[model samples]
Target: MAAPITAALLIIGDEILSGRTKDKNIGYIAEYLTGVGIDLCEVRIVPDVEDEIVAALNSLRQRYTYLFTTGGIGPTHDDITADAVARAFGVGIDHDPRAVAMLRERYQPHELNEARLRMARIPDGADLIENPISKAPGFKIGNVFVMAGVPAIMQSMLDTIAPTLQTGARMLAETIEAEGLAEGNYAAGLADIASAHPGVSIGSYPSFSTSGFRNQIVVRGRDPVAVARAVAAVQDLLHRLKSDGVPH
Candidate 1:
């Protein structure tokens, strides 16, 4: 059996909590992790407070194989992700010489102030995650990767660290779309089919249509053969239902 690689996302921004800014990182990272054979199991949105951020970081970092955080590591006063991360790990946060030098090389003296230098403050013994869109880099302490608030910057930083992360066997999914079918009618058969295929994950999607209700079932598994078997099993269930005088 292949080992499971689970991931969690921590969105650190009061804007998301207050509904001022819609959080897009969770969905984006979830898709990315799924593409790379990592399952994203949990996502949390925390405010700018130090205690809350530290507690969330500590909880998620140890619980999952990989923990990803976005937002709050910015030039502004409320950006305290770095400080909170350091506190969570019980390490002191300081401006790395390399990061400082990189910042100095990229920006003029006036642009490099206390606020801007805050970006360079990384937790001790942490590796840096490169930000292609923005010069300010993100850092990885233990399993937690602290990234930027901007979607573009966060995405680019994720790309740099994804290669180093451990991934599970890629899951294969087969989608079956049936028109004008009520999910309630298919429930018993669906349950039986799913029970037969223990390795497969079967999900039923229902939607409203002009003709009637529509149902789409997707069967997913890490093993290709098992996924195919499960799809066949679902098809057999549908065929049996149709044969029993149920209009599908």
Candidate 2:
């Protein structure tokens, strides 16, 4: 199998860290990347300070195939993600005519104040990612993609950038519902199975409710045969534990 294409997410906003603005992008981006055969390996939420954003950007962009950032691209004074990105790449940032034109589509000449024009700032040599909703374009420089903080706009930008990404082997997964089985009864056996099938990853998830514990074992891998074999082993383990009178 080819090496997996990996990505890291940098969520930038003082509002998120201060608990004033709840984040809705992390899970959305994670699932999106997974569906498109890109592995999202790490995520970081940083404050709006330019230094903090620049530091996180440099670190993540170097380690992953791509780095995605949401927040701090707005028109407000606190929106410093673009400047941080420019400094991180050692590139100059200025008002790009393309981005300015996009913003013009939404705002009239008189309404395009200095504050609103801040959204038109783009790093040198970056390609603009279109925003159909608000007309403020996100940008891609090197491997770092800067996007809006709003979930809807970020999702739209993701759609625009999807086709440009290089994907890898799609992960295959199987969920074995061990409804009546407790995780403790199967932990050791599952570990053994996981060790036996080196190519597949096995995980146990249990949720509690008024009825009690609902358990599930998920086997995941890039290879279908490997995932299937691991799933069968998990099922057999559950069966044996049931026969041996293990607690529910």
| TM-score versus the correct structure, for each prediction | 0.94, 0.98
Tell me, by TM-score, which candidate is best: 2
Worst 10 residues of 1 by lDDT: 177-186
lDDT of each residue in 1-248, candidate 2, tens digit only:
89999999999988999999999999999999999999999999988788888899999999999999999999999999999999999999999999999999999999999999999999999999999999999999999999999999999999999999999988888999996788888898888998899998899988888988899899989999888888888989888888888877
Worst 10 residues of 2 by lDDT: 179-188
**Local distance difference test, each candidate:** 0.88, 0.93
Q: In model 2, which runs have C-alpha deviations exceeding 4 angstroms?
A: none
Clashes of each: 0, 0
Off by over 4 Å in 1: 209-212
